[model samples]
Target: MNIFDIPAQAWAGQILIGLINGSFYAILSLGLAVIFGLLNIVNFAHGAFYMMGAMATWMLGNYLGLGYWASMLLAPLLVGLVGIVLERLFISRIYHLDHTYSMLLTYGMTLMIESLFRNAYGTSGLPYSAPVALQGGTNLGVLFMPNYRLWVVGAAVAVCLATWLLIEKTRLGAYLRAATENASMARALGINVPRMLTLTYGCGVGLAALAGVFAVPVYGANPAMGSDLLIVVFAVVAIGGMGSILGSIVTGLVLGLMEGLTKVVYPEASTTVVFVAMIIVLLVKPTGLFGESR
Candidate 1:
């Protein structure tokens, strides 16, 4: 084989890994986009929601005797309800304030939530088993792939597309945008602006939680898990465009592919490649790859 040539197995494996990571990036950043774009709140506690998803899934299994499939359905809903409560009690209060205020408040919440979980569960991570149906691997031509991972990628993609459609193409989405653009005008038009904001925030956090539930099947349940990837996911949002849903999905998948390719071409640069791409994008277009100027 030529020095420049790469083996199919190695390439395919890395691509799979990258796609898996990208699936997560797309989902997480999409949530951030929805929250910021519609609600104007910079939610720094998204990672905690992610962790909560995983923790909730784990708890459902270990405590409630719920299996993976059932937990997957229930955990995100549970986390989302918690998010709604948080929104009503805390986030709503800061809605009238600047984005910095929301960011700071959510950041404080992140710290507090993390600490509480740490105290209760300790730092050790909990394992979550994949459903029996997804326990094994499939034999692809190039490499063996896990059924669960493939499911994750497909599910993430479906969720992202559905959300994008809902936001960009639906009557309800139009109302969301209208409320976002002019709350007073929307309220005059008979839209429930405040309720809309509350629901949007809850949904955004729910998206983060859904992503977290996807993770437990792979990385297990850990309080700090979300914090670990929070920065990278933020970089993803910035690179894609701060509040652009489509941008988040596209940038996440592309950057994920780049990260994987970098791991193959040069292992050391894989970690830094995303930030480097972010810096480049920021320099070239501060509005992000897809952001519209205000």
Candidate 2:
């Protein structure tokens, strides 16, 4: 069939794929927003952490016989602990420096990590099969949707919501927000701002690692996979707003769907669609769809 003459089933499938992509974008960008908003540092190593998480899951399965479900929890925790150490040792040292320093430090770290993995694993992607329970597909009338993809969407939504409520409604979230708004004031009020910042950074990287774990079954663990998606995620964050939590979630999903739609109508532009949206959003809103104007 001609591209223009694609069937409804094809459209449904593409939309489902788009939603799945969007789910990942939302989760990744949510972590970015939390880190940038609270810590005032752009984490360039985020994508690296994601790669580590996927690698960790693969390692855990191959060596330790851990399943996908177990990897989901264990991988993040292990990666998060590493993040905590990095924060304490390196990231904490650069808190007083310019944002460029943090970005450069993280970027260098990303390159180092990617090189290490490339040397060990080679360029070929590793295999990671989905759990047997999620290995089937569900017929949705017009489309046959994969069970794993549906689970991904549901899990992403649940994670984003839980994160939002934690940041917007919970007591600890209040402290985080307070520190974000005015670290000195928060500290004066007895909040341990530095400790909170360290934890926040760790949490953000942990979230990225969690995304990687979720992605392993679909994309397989690869050294450069995270870098490939990082650019698009940066666009998503920009289009949604830098520090706006809701903006990141909404923008990520919307852009993912839009990218999918572009694939249907204009296949050549599919890859650039999110960046185009980013430019348009910058021109119109400047602060992003959900970002507050400073």
Candidate 3:
């Protein structure tokens, strides 16, 4: 159990795996945070949207010979466009009502979407293999890591950083923040707040779709994938304190790594670690590790 005597390869392998899983949690929770921050909607259908992205990639690949790269780009755009339509057609209608109404509406939308997918694809899981270009592994001195997994982790980190910069350093981000905080004020100042809202929702949904595209090869395309993931993501967001996008990304990766470590010591506790951490976080800092006390 000494530090130098520990199994280095096994430890490195688990860490790599954890980092990859963390990447997914970070990107997914980031999408959730952005939507919640701007729209004030819980977006219960976020998971479904993510699932749809994976399914879209699978269908495109099978029917049109779309590669992973193409689907990675195309799926998000298509799903994002769908989100725009959903915002205009449904989300906009609930803006003036109580929060509960919107939550219920979104929940209903999730159920409908899930049911539709279940009817079409059945409950069984589908097979999805990693693209040939990234199907192998390489030794990194200490451990062998799958190329695709590395890509996923690198992509997620880059995305999270890019998004953080976009929101914190860009003019568009300024406008977005202004419009989100005070739509009427922004509208008076000549900003098209409604259009911005729709676009924001699209972006959020797009991020989810992006996560889905990346996840399909790893997790496969399935209807229940979203609901199951959604619960975990909710915990990630809650623990990270949805007020800050960067916070969400950081917390997700941290929890993901923690879960991985837990798996090494106590396999049975892996699944419970995140929730346990979440509970402890809530007890100590009700708003979360980086959440604001508004």
Q: Count the backbone clashes (under 3 Å) in each candidate.
A: 0, 0, 0
Q: Which segments of model 2 are wrong by more than 4 Å? A: 1-5
Best by lDDT: 1
Question: How well is each residue in 60-145 modelled by candidate 2, as lDDT tens digits?
Answer: 99999999999999998999899899899898888778989989998998999899999999988999999998989998999778
Cα-based TM-score, every candidate: 0.97, 0.96, 0.95
Candidate 1, lDDT over the whole model: 0.92
User: Which residue window of length 10 is worst by lDDT in model 3?
Assistant: 1-10
Give the 10-residue window scoring lowest on summed lDDT in candidate 2: 1-10
Candidate lDDT scores, in order, read: 0.92, 0.90, 0.88
Tell me the deviation in Å of residue 230 in model 1: 0.5
Q: Candidate 2 has which clashing residue pairs, if any?
A: none
Clashing pairs in 1: none
For residues 43-124, could you state the per-residue lDDT of candidate 3 as single tens digits?
A: 8899999998999999889999999989999999999999899999999988777779878988898999889989999988
Among all candidates shown, the one with the greatest TM-score: 1
Weakest 10 consecutive residues of candidate 1 by summed lDDT: 1-10
